[model samples]
Target: MTRLAYSALSSYSRVQIMRLVQDHPGRTITDLCDETGLHANTVREHVQRLIEGGYLVAETERRTTRGRPRVLYSAATGEAAASSPIARRKAEEAARRGDLMRRVLPWTADAELPSDALHQIDALVEDLGDAGFDPIIDEGALTVDLSPCPHASADGSHRDVLCAVHQGLMEGVLTQAGGPLRIAQITTSCDPSTCVVMLRR
Candidate 1:
């Protein structure tokens, strides 16, 4: 993942915008402004940042008889987002960084795992680390434990959107990593202290 992508999530307002787009794809800027009560300029800036970060996709609405179609936004997904040249290049760079960290760090136990699985975990860890999840991997159980999750502060009503977006990001990472491992599920909690992400081969 790129630093830009991680930084995009650092703002709570941006996170809310992301969740809104994820829940309701093809939302126009006006719709986001209406829902978020943010100024139109602020929403436009946030959306532009999200688009640059590869977290959101923008498309023009199609209309038969209209002066102009509105611009719509939606959350980027694993397959579609990773297909972009820039996104693929970033993923490849992240994979290289993950490999470097694995080699230099104290993750000696990772040696026992298959090469592909290790690569997947390396990518996952790097991405999660960038997002400040403080991920702990359970190799035997094929799960990643996230403690003091950055996204845990979201209100209960938006919890589902938070988790789903996170899960989608993980899937995107794995897909970009070109590994055999995948995110099977993410179990979120009412408490912000912990979340579990299950992996499957």
Candidate 2:
């Protein structure tokens, strides 16, 4: 993760917004304000920060008639190349980090694991590390075990939100990494000691 993205997600409010948008795309600022109980200006600021960090994408809402179209925000799923210069730079940095991490990390010498899978794993591991997941990868099972989740202290609804945001983050990273690998499921336990993320082609 780039510094900007790290900073953007550091705010709990922003993570909530990300989780909301990821769950329901094309949400307007007013919608976010109502759901989050944040002032419209505050919601707009958070949304803009998410956009600048490349965690969210913004679009002009389509309208048949009437006043100006509302601006909608949704999680960035890496469907398209980075649109802004800041986002582009962050992406380049992430790619560089992924390459460097792959080089320093141990790998299965046997050709059992394809290069594409390795690339995807590298990206996922890098992002998880940045987010303080301390991931342990099992190449054989194609699963990642995340221990001591940073937000493990959160309970109930907050826990659900954290899990959703984390899952979305992984999905975005995997998509951007550009490989056949994808997240099949993420099993999060009430006991924050460990959360297993299963991946598949």
User: Each model's RMSD to truth, in Å?
Assistant: 3.3, 3.0
Best by TM-score: 2
Runs in model 2 with CA error above 4 Å?
A: 80-92, 100-110
In order, the Cα lDDT scores of the candidates are 0.75, 0.76
Q: TM-score per candidate, in order?
A: 0.77, 0.83
lDDT per residue for candidate 1 within 92-184, as digits (tens), equals 776677677767885554656676677678767866877877888998889999977776677877766667677877786677667678888
Candidate 2 clashing pairs, residues 3+ apart or interchain: none
lDDT of 2 at 107: 56
